[model samples]
Target: MATGESRARSIGQQATGRTVLKTHPGSKTAVLVALAALVTGCGGSASDTAPTKPSAGHRAGSGSGSDGSSAGTVGFDTVFKTEERFQQALPDPASMAGWTPRNASALIEDDPEPAARCAPSRDWECAKIAHGEANFEAFGEEADFDITAFVDKAGAGEACRKEATWSAKYTKAPGAAVSDVESHAYYRNVGGENGLYVTMCLGTVVAEVTLAGPNSSLDPDTAHSLARQFVPRIQKAAAAS
Candidate 1:
């Protein structure tokens, strides 16, 4: 459960349009990345479009609840088999090349309130059983990296699409990717900093890669490539589960 102050901050963020990330004993880049998904955190409206017909990489079922809101779920266990598996799924320093990981290890969250407040809407705040994230800082560059994966309940393709569409609407981003998988890329300014937020869904797993920094050399294309690179990794991990 969240403390009163934490809950208050959550409400404040939604009500006042002011984003505040509670201090974590993690790296600075992690804190900054939390702001990247603030506006579209967990809760989504009923108006966004939901994909009909089961898409590849998503389980078949109805798109959303008859109420036209995000469909609820009973949730899942670790999306990855374990915390170690979740960490192993993230891109390493060698894979990232120019970026050096800042956090001592991936930050894993099983708590609902904070992640529900910090992640993108389709990332499914409350439905996630485990959320793992890591931060990296570019060598001799202003860029930073924040990537996350979620263990969410399966069968919410339409709800997830609805949430993603809602977030894209606010970011003025293009629609979801037209591929065998369900994915999206959004480039925009959040909390006054420029960022590219790319996300994908494979079964019960949701993955997001965000590149953000003030005066950062990173661009939308870089984030897009990273998301693409992560796809197979996430698929393998989800398969193991």
Candidate 2:
């Protein structure tokens, strides 16, 4: 849970609209209007989108790796799977200890509060933590890596598009050469179960991890690491969830 002061600070930052992605002019109006309608129809105020209930039977997949290492399960809600090679490619955590969350909550809060927009999953509990938004999805499923930890660096084209508006910033992991730094982007599947969307970062050394669920908050790097540590444990929990 976040302290009152922390939450207040977060709210203040949000109110100032500092990190809101600058959308293209032609589409910006439409997007904002559509988002407004979504909030209104969901019985959520313009500012609050947290849901009141939990989703049921969120099926996840669980499996073991060829080497007998635990390959985590994927739930029905799971959108994409990370390849083993990709997980192995991540840089050592020791090299990234200094790569702490940099205003990570800003990244997570890019979207509206989910608690009002969608229900929490039965396997998980939704809460707003200090680091960011978090969804305590009970892992009944298992996988080799936490699918969420992987960050997506925007592609060249996307990066170029973004560059037209704002300068792109790249942070290289300690000891990682400039060439090793890569860009990725957030991906979400649309058209299913209210269409799940995820906003996260991907780096050469960092793996992708789920930042938030439908009605949860995102956690910072430390929290993300803690969650990653439980990748194997959560595989079981997700299977059970």
**Candidate 2, TM-score vs. the true structure?**
0.19
* Residue pairs with backbone overlap in model 1: none
Model 2, range 1-241, lDDT digits (tens) per residue? 1111211112112233443333443222111111111112223243333222222321221111122224443222221122222223222222122221111111121222233332323211122211212122222211112223211222212322332223123221212111111323232333431111212222211223333335322223323333334333323322332
Model 2 score (lDDT): 0.24
Q: Tell me the lDDT of model 2 at 188.
A: 32
lDDT of 1 by residue, 95-127 (tens): 443344443123444343444453444444443
Q: What is the lDDT of residue 58 in candidate 2?
A: 16
lDDT of 2 at 25: 34
lDDT of each candidate versus the true structure: 0.43, 0.24
